[model samples]
Target: MIELNWEGVYPAVLTPFKENGDIDFEMFAKNTEAQIKAGVHGIIIAGSLGDAAVLEMDEKFELLTFTIKVVNGRVPVILNIAENTTKNAVNFAVKAKQLGADGLMLLPPMRYKADDREAVEYFKAVANATDLPILIYNNPVDYPVFVSLAMFEELQLCPTIKAVKESTRDLTNITRMKNRFRDRYKILAGVDTISLEALAVGADGWVFGLVDAFPKETVAMYNHVKNGEFAKALELYRWFMPLLELDIHPKLIQYIKLAATAEGISTPYLRAPRLPLVGEEAERINKVIADGIASRPKLD
Candidate 1:
């Protein structure tokens, strides 16, 4: 089993598509390289921001394989498992390990809204099926299930379940988890808007969305906070807040891809049933991206 440090900024990378809806491995490689160049601690492929819900199983594996090749062990390449059934999740976890993934970002059973016990069982079932280190994604606001601190107590029994992506959007939970677990589990801030605040309170890392586009600033902000340069971190955070707010929006895929496109790292194309942003919506989001680019902070 490869040990993942599971700290620092890890991007829930977006899957870029060509206009005809094909996975653009070239663009994907470019984006992965950009993340590596910006010094991200890890790369999470097939995540929510990656549009995993719409991706075919084969497509997911291909993306995973390609990312592992691109990263080439410079940093961990964690796969995201967001399946609706325990059987499917377990199968994916097994395949992920076989395919050379360093770790996993596991979500609760998707769409069905499993309760706490079922959610815990679902996680444990997958954990028991594979030796990969798991980071339980607990985002009740976006995802239907919420893994509370009490539930985490149950999860601790499964040593493979090693970390928590704390996306409940409650800053207090950071302190609560730290106070209770005290390093038993790594607590990563999953919500982008409150990441700096979460870090201040004691988040071990950030599982971020906008880092797909603003990697340098995102990474610099995390490094600043981790190094206790709060003033510099805040300066970057205040400038980044407007753009960071885009990550929480429903159209986050389009928003973040636009930011990446603005940086020349990604194309703005999205897979269908999802369409491109247009009209006032496009203009509005473009302004946010534009303002962000115009005033991007210079870090040393």
Candidate 2:
């Protein structure tokens, strides 16, 4: 199993697409380069922010392979597994390791809303199938099943499950997890809006969304907080709140892609049933992105 310190900012990357709906590998590489250049600790592909549900299995593998090549080990590349069944999840986990994924952000059974036993068993089954380290994604606000701390007590028995992407959105859970487990699990702040607070309260890392577009600002915030420059971090965070709030919207993929486009990193092409933002929505989001770029903070 690969040893990951699992510390620092890891962006849940946006999957860039062409106008005709094909995966835009060129733009994808450009986006990856921006993250690497900004000194992000790692990158996550095929995540909720990346529109993983709409991607086919082959596309997922292709993105993972392509990302590894583009990254070239400059930073660790983690894949998100959103499978609905234990069997398929295990198969994908095995394949991800074989295809050179550094680690995984594993989600609970999709659509079924697995009970505590089923969720625990599902996670254990995947852990047993692979040697890859796992960050169990615990986002109850968006995903139906929430992996509670008690469930994590059971998961601790699985040695490879190393981290938690804590997007439960309750700030106290950060304190609760640390108080309960100590350093047993690395806690990554998964939601963007409250990320500074998460870092202030002792999250080990951030699994970010808007960082897909604003890598430098994201990395700056984390670095400031880590370096005990709380005032600097707060200054950036206050400026960053409007853009960070985009991560929580239902159409975040479109909104974030547009934000990236505004910054000249990625194009705003989304796969269907998901459409491009238009009219009032487009103008509104564009203004937010434009205003953010215009007033982007200058850090020293």
Candidate 3:
């Protein structure tokens, strides 16, 4: 396995499913290939955007094994662990490492909202379980628990608890993390809408959903920003915002799948409880994707 470079665009890729509720490995390959070809640095599988909650543990490993083979060591493949218990999370983390995962994107405990101590301890347990580097999914806005800076202080003892997928949405937290931790944690912007802003304000990379749909444009914007081409990146970001906002919605899985379907890289099909979009919601989001695609800026 290669070293885990926690910087650059890592798509929290969706699990494309067939109508029969089985994994669509064909569509999955298409999307993952698109991302890597477009210059993304890493891939995160089975995230919230990947419909992680509904997936069986065996199903997730199936995705992981297939992704690792598809990726072919071209880039790091990080699996997301969202189990409801520490024991399960630890067990999954061990298996993920054994299965050739480059890293783990471990979320706080599911269902029950753990307090600071509990959350920190939970993270520590998983870190101790596997040698795989971890990216803590710190999305308090969506998840019930918030991994505060103080809690991170307690988590520092776990050397394997590496980068953070910063989804707090408060951009200042990026600065605070930098101030307190220095280079200890690589802060990747987890919110798609504010990704450019996060990068501008010192985020090391972006762990986003929209990249699954618009890989070229997403990678282009990241390059423009890193090259100090603010005018160019902002112009692209302004045009990309409407489609990007689709990642933050309650039905983000549905919305992103629709966007990817429009691009011909993914299907609109999803697992149970997450049906395809329809009616006005579908129409509105489709228009945003259509308009974005129609007006997409030329990338050199």
Badly placed stretches (over 4 Å) of model 1 are none
**lDDT of candidate 3 over 141-254, digit per residue (tens):** 999888899988888889998999999999999999999999999999999999998998899999989999999999999999989899999999999999999998899999
Q: What is candidate 2's lDDT per residue for 118-164, written digit by digit as tens?
A: 99999999999998999999998899888998999999999999999
Alpha-carbon deviation at 259 in model 2, angstroms: 0.3
Candidate 3, 114: how far from true, in Å? Answer: 0.7
Clashing pairs in 3: none
What lDDT score belongs to each candidate, Candidate 1 first? 0.91, 0.93, 0.93
Name the runs in model 2 displaced over 4 angstroms. Answer: none
* RMSD of each candidate relative to the true structure: 0.9, 0.9, 0.8
Q: How many Å off is the CA of 235 in candidate 3?
A: 1.0
Cα deviation in Å at residue 289, candidate 1? 0.4
Clashes of each: 0, 0, 0
Cα shift from native, residue 164, model 3 (Å): 0.5
